[model samples]
Target: MKALAGDLGIETAVSFPGRLTTDELSSLLGTAWINLHFSVAEGWCLSVMEAAAAGVPTVAYEVPGISESVVPGTSGLLAKDGDIGDLTNRVTEILHSPQHWWASSRRVVESRGWDRVAEDWERYLTVVFSSA
Candidate 1:
């Protein structure tokens, strides 16, 4: 990754914080303007949710699990998997426009929270248990 970044003339910072506590992770996420996720597949991306909670938008490929978290043009923009150009364009688009960037951040903040998730699960579980 470092070599690729250098070849592209992009500056890179490599940190090997092997493990981090939740608080440490939150603090790190809070400082980021955007999170870039390039995974081919994921069941659920806790990192993406964490980034959203920190009011940082994400840029990721439009894959199944990732798509659910990052709604294109809402929480973040999505590019076709393996399309580096599209991904680069999307990132540039968001970073170049403050209005778009803040709008996406606002959407993420307004859309989900731990309280909301718990309430949703509680409601669903209540129905399931009652039916049983």
Candidate 2:
């Protein structure tokens, strides 16, 4: 990986933190401009959710679990699965325009969180109990 980065004239810093605490992960996410989720298969990617919660948009493939969190052109952009060219273009688009980046960031920050989810769940439970 280092060799490939060097060949591409990119700098890379590899780390093996092993396990990161929630606070540590949050701190790392806070400093990121964007997050890249390349998972071909995932189950409700918590990393992507955490990135959104931290106001960091994502560039991800249009796949299950991931699609639920990243709303294209709102929270971030999505590319066809396995399309590296489209993924690169989407990422470049986000990086090139500060206005677009800020818009996406704001959208992500304003999107539903745990509080809203819990409230919705409570409402559903109440309706179910009352019906019964």
Candidate 3:
């Protein structure tokens, strides 16, 4: 990945701070412009819902479990599965179109009540990660 970035003359400034705390993740979500989910498969992704809760729109593939979280034009943009070109276009569209981004963020925020979801998430995470 680093080699490709360097070869393409791309200044990859982002760093992977391993294992973020809840506070750090929350802080990131608050400032994030958009959430990008490239997971090949997920079971009702919490990250997607979390992004909606923070008023951050999402760009992801149109897959089963993920589709439940992202409401296409309403909550976020979705690309065709395994299509990088489509994913790039979706991300670009969300970034360039401010009104769409605003509408998505507003709709996501208006439609979801995250209080109960958050509690469920904590419990789910605990159980899921305990044996990981």
| Model 2: residues with Cα > 4 Å off, grouped in runs | 1-17, 98-111, 130-132
After superposition, the stretches of candidate 3 with alpha carbons farther than 4 Å from their true spots are 1-11, 114-132
lDDT string for model 3 (6-98, tens) is: 787774664455688889987877877888899878888888877776777899998889888898887788999999999999888888875
User: Residue by residue across 23-104, what tens digits does model 2's lDDT show?
Assistant: 9998887777888999998888778777877777889999999888787877788999999999999999888874566556
Query: Candidate 1 at residue 112, lDDT?
Result: 78
Q: What is the lDDT of candidate 1?
A: 0.79
Worst 10 residues of 2 by lDDT: 9-18
State residue 10's C-alpha deviation in candidate 2, in Å: 3.4
Task: Tally clashing residue pairs in candidate 1.
Answer: 0
Q: In model 3, what lDDT does residue 3 have? A: 70
* TM-scores of all predicted structures: 0.74, 0.77, 0.70
Model 1: per-residue Cα lDDT at residue 105: 68
Check candidate 2 and list the clashing pairs. Answer: none
Question: Which candidate ranks first by TM-score, i.e. highest?
Answer: 2
